[model samples]
Target: MPAFVGAIKINDISGSAVVNIGDVFHIEPRSQTKTFAGAGSFNTGNYLRVKNGYSVTHTVDADNVDNSNIGNT
Candidate 1:
């Protein structure tokens, strides 16, 4: 299964509920972190962590992530 970052969620074409990250489980593929500190360009981070059992933190590299705008494409 693919991982998610931030509050970005993935829904099937049927629009069914998938899963939500609650900072609990510390799921995988959390490197796709996109934070909006300001308004002007998107701030992309290469590292992301999910707290496992609210204790250990798991981190992974984004591996050349792209955050360019696509405007409706």
Candidate 2:
């Protein structure tokens, strides 16, 4: 089926957002990735002693797709 959209209000779209209007057969092409680094704390001014251990890691699953072709005509 189809639809009738009224006057739209202008706002903002995030890094990952989708907007669709009227009828559509399908929608494709979407991706996401997240990565981080270690964080620590330190102070200086006169003398300070501290010991800390903070780490961050990232991993990709074997089932993840990369450099591949999908969908069909």
Cα displacement (angstroms), candidate 1, residue 28, comes to 25
Clashing pairs in 1: none
Candidate 1 whole-model C-alpha lDDT, 0 to 1 = 0.44
Model 1, range 1-73, lDDT digits (tens) per residue?
5555665656563333235555455433422444433332344576745333434333444666565433422
- Model 2 Cα lDDT, one tens digit per residue, 3-33: 8988987599776666777788877546545
Q: After the best TM-score superposition of candidate 2, give how far the Cα of residue 5 lies from its true spot, in angstroms.
A: 1.0
Estimate the Cα RMSD of every predicted model relative to the unseen true structure: 16.4, 10.5
